[model samples]
Target chain A: MSTIFAHGGQLAHGVLLTMLMTVLGFGCALVAGVVLAVFHISPVPPLHRLAVGYVAVFRNIPLLVWLVLFVFGLPEIGLLYPLFGTVTAAMALYWAAFICEAVRSGIRTVPPGQIEAARALGFGFSQLLRHLVLPQAVRSMVQPLGTVFIALTLNTSLAAAVGVRELTGETQFFTITYDIPIPAFAVTTAIYVLITLAGGLLTGRLERKLAFKR
Target chain B: MNTGASTLFDLPGPAGRRRIRIATVVSLLLIVVAVVAVVRRLTTHGMLAADEWRVFTQWPTIRFLLGGVWATVLVTVVAMAIALPAGALVALVRLSRARVARALGRAYVEVFRAIPLLLLLYMFLFGLPRLGLTFPVFWQLTLAIVLNNAAVFAEILRAGILAVERGQSEAASSLGMTYWQAMWLVVIPQAVRKVVPALVGQSVRLLKDSSLGYVVSYLELLHQSQVLGEYYHTVLPTYLVAAVVYIAINITLSRFAHLLENRGLRGVRRRRHPESTALAENAAIGSGGRAPLIDDSTV
Candidate 1:
């Protein structure tokens, strides 16, 4: 049991991996989400349909299933990979669908008058999107995006199934090795609670700041 | 932002058309590439072995999956049953005149809401034994779901309750109802109606999140799928089936909610609007008013 904490370095390594996955996956999801939201709200009929379908499928399917499909199912045809990359890619893809919808909702909340104003000011499509639409949309998006980030952080725990030594995986390893499930898991839960609370606090402050700006 | 319908198609002529065409082609090409990559991978690896496919058809896996479905349903129903009442209580507590009760209610909500559902399940399953409390797998899972979901539902219900007109509560009190009676009989009824859509939405979420039980080795659908995958080494098919089952169930539930929402609105109109009620009653009286009376009373 003493050996578990004695090897605190291993736990730190796991925490590092967890943070890396959260940042990378969420970063990718944000970019993909913005792009998809643009397409979804665009005047192009085909793009709109495609974006809708993408959201429907990904949003409906379980994230674990997506992870399995990428890790186990994808390699069958020859797209082999290191497990880490596969799991990360899968997480990014799955969350991208959700984030896209959030961004779209945010974008929709921007009044049409704002867009019209931008147009009347002689703004082109790109300019209007960059200057007027995106800034307001992003403001409205702060709260939802914060929730998504927390979700992404929590969901990264699922990557443990694919053998990524994230915090959960490390806790599992210590539990099995020490044969003391309670203490190991207690520590894990505490860590999770701490991180989530910090996130909530930070996001709450940001939300207030954004509201004040408006 | 009413940009008007004409703005949708008012692109800047030939160059704009050409650019749009190029953009469409590029997006399509990207999707095609991704699809081809996925298809190529799926076909080559032969995800399910022949024997594994046979095993999936076997009675035990079938029974297990079906049993998992039942467990999932039971857990959801029981959890929501508990959560609804518990959530209402918590909401009432939060809205109570007493500061201590409100603080306690608010604390419970914040703590539970911030904690991930999966971690809560783990705590219930593994943590309780140390404190000399034990529950069977089903109860443990159900309790975890209820606790986590109640926190969320409490918030939702409180929002709904707050959305109700302050006059409604005052009116109930003015009519000689006690605070509790006013809450339960008047405030809650209206609040529930307003929150029906969101309640259904959360129920769908609960159904999906129940899959998290797999982590604690609860034999829900995902757990059943994992077992089959371990046995037959057909990880993908088993999960695919589970995913499809979940999606099908949720879609059906959502459609039902939509139907109920439409019916409920109609019901509200017929009951609340005296003019509509009179018209409906008159139309019914011409054809025997019993049916409309029954409908109106039900609403």
Candidate 2:
């Protein structure tokens, strides 16, 4: 316990980095994911196929493999980014595929009747999307997106693999240096639990606020 | 179910058809251009050098990598064997009438689910040795994965158990069955069947996670590829091949889950909202665990 308190500053930095990565990664994922979802459901056939292929390829691969590839392999082709930037980008690219699916699923929740009603009212494609589909779809998406965010937060630990010194890395440092594995791990686990609990609560609140009323 | 694209847009009139056709062609051309540029860049960097890939054709190299695949499968199989039954037990405990049991179960699932698998693996790999409690490297990786995945499987199984209609267990009780007997005989089997697709989906995650064996020097596929790449001095190409291999195996598993869903084997409760149902499937697909449970609060 003393060991944990002694390293409180390091742990705090780890938590901050992990949070930064999750937020940045999720932001990138959101933009790419929404675009992919639109392309997936767009009237354009080839773009739909491209989106399908993109999700399949990215979603199927492991996050660690993607990170290693980006961190180590990309330099062979002259595309170099900082270690932190590269890992976050890899995470964003990988998770964007999942977010695309979540968004697509959210869109599907907008009932066929609602869509038909919009068509009957002579709404154009863009207007239907803006006025009817996206609003409700975005509402339904909140919970799932929250789930994705939590998962991303946990995954940010993998950034430690490429030398990000996130929560997991800091925990390792404490354990090795102080020879207090139990205290080190327990403190880190508690911090992670707190992070996830906070995320879940915030998401539940947002989900309720955004929920569509009949 | 309706195809999402078709539902999003009206059936094309002649003008719409023409527009779609032009859009398709334009998108195809853009994709082709992107591909060409990527290929050109790789060529310029000598990344596409034929000799770098030639190792794949050799029987010895192929055999070596297959050994890695076998090791990965072995780890995944052993971990799954332990995790599946353990997860069921955890799920049953969470469903127990005793509040203490439920809390303990929830704590187990929530903690493991919250902690990343790599951190757990590191604890096993590095921490336990200091306590003079070392297992073989294989058990270290496999057990770490089991700890995390058992919690996940518990959540998936709990979802299935809850999805089973309440009346089924009530009927079993009316027939003079004990609560445990009803759960074991009537409820659990049906629950397992309902969530088999989700279970398969989780297995894909397990299989991909087995690749983390690379971190512990377990000589899994990625590790083997890394060694091979070092031997041939073609690290990027080797990792790409390994990535392709991981993608191929996971894609097959994911497709199986989709097949099960499409065959109407998802669960007993038919979700009224298409978004809810889709999110459920996406939960299995996307997240580590926490698969949009019957009651989301439990997570």
Candidate 3:
């Protein structure tokens, strides 16, 4: 294990990729979720329906379905990302549905009186959403959204199915190459466990801080 | 997770309604254009052909897939069987009086919950050969799924346990019951009832996750779909079929769970609310378990 780490073996690289994918996928989920949530709550009936339909389809379909479909179907639509990119993109889309739900619910936590006040002050739709609604919505969202993103951390390993040499793939590759399956698996598993524990703790702390500020 | 009666602004006036109508038309146009682009290409490739779907009725393919469904169900049943009880025990350990027991229980839940189910599956399936205990694909996959879910179940059960009023336990102890007696006879049963919806959600997750067994060559429903693809030289059709199967099974499972939950809810005589703890539990535990595609809380 020490030698593998010292030489930056496949397992090490895989662990690195896993964390990278989590951060990247999580960022995409956040942005896409905010967009979808905005459309969902927008006064425009068609835009709201479109967003609702988006969440319905994406959320109903399993991540595996999107991963497989994007791999096989994207080129037909004239989108051509590599295996890793496709997997990450699909994950972001899948997670965005859940994030949209969290964000929508968070927006609900913003009192109706607040919206009325903003309207009375002549705040436009965009201005009200940007200046008034989003700030408070985000605060309520911090904990639930944190939990969802932490789940994203584990789902990153699913990328390995489409031939991304993330942690799981790396674990298999290193195990095969070094003929040290037990140690390789043990080490990679431990790293993920530690990361998950840390994420949960960090989110809890963040939630507390947000609560205190409120 | 379930957003109730929420709107961004007041109902639109006449002018506002006109804008909304225009926005609807524009959104529909965009969606139609995108859908057409994809459909046109698929038609060009013969992917939309009725002939490709006839294989769904073929005995060889259907039987193979049916076998896969059984495999998926078997995995779910076995994992749930072990994980549920084991999770409860772990929850007890988490709430144990002993510091070491609590720490060890916490470590177990944290570790298993953190690791991806697929990676854990790989670790057990591939790594076990090095430990002189290679399991059949079934056992290996089951072990991974059970371990992964048990940690999460433990946490959920722990929360449910905590949610039970402390006074109940106090009353039990004051009545000359031992701590174990109070927990066994009083606390656990109530906790389980309160969290039935969450447990049901987890069970469905175990079913869906069993599809991951395909990676290890478990010949589960997803793998059988791949087998159909291999023979037919068509990937999307086979995958779509598999997804349909998964969706159907999950829908049924959740429906049954809801039925059971409704009966329980009625007996408990809880106040009826549109948004139950079920959705909230689904969202929170789903962060750790499987996500429901449609809002199950609507049931």
True contacts kept of 1: 0.23
Q: Candidate 1 or 3, higher DockQ?
A: 3
Judging by DockQ against the true structure, name the best candidate. 2
Q: What tens-digit string does per-residue lDDT give for candidate 1 at B234-276?
A: 7777788787887777777767766665676678676686664
Candidate 3 residue lDDT tens string, A66-118: 78778864564456787877888889998998898878767877877888888
Give one digit per residue, the lDDT tens place, for model 3 in B102-212: 999988887788878988878777777767888888998898899988887898789878978899899999999999999999899778876666677678767867878
Give the clash count for model 1.
6
Candidate 2 lDDT over residue span B151-259, tens digit each:
9899989988998889989999999999999999989876776576557757877888888887889999988988988899888998998889887777766665566
lDDT of 1 by residue, A28-130 (tens): 9899988887777666556777887787677666676677667776554567898888888888888887788677656756777777777877888778777
Predicted complex 1: CAPRI docking category = acceptable
Q: Candidate 3 DockQ category?
A: acceptable
All candidates in order of lDDT, best leading: 2, 3, 1
TM-score of 2: 0.91
Clashing pairs in 3: none
lDDT of each: 0.73, 0.83, 0.77
> Candidates ranked by DockQ, best first?
2, 3, 1
**Candidate 1 vs candidate 2: which has greater DockQ?**
2
Off by over 4 Å in 2: B256-299
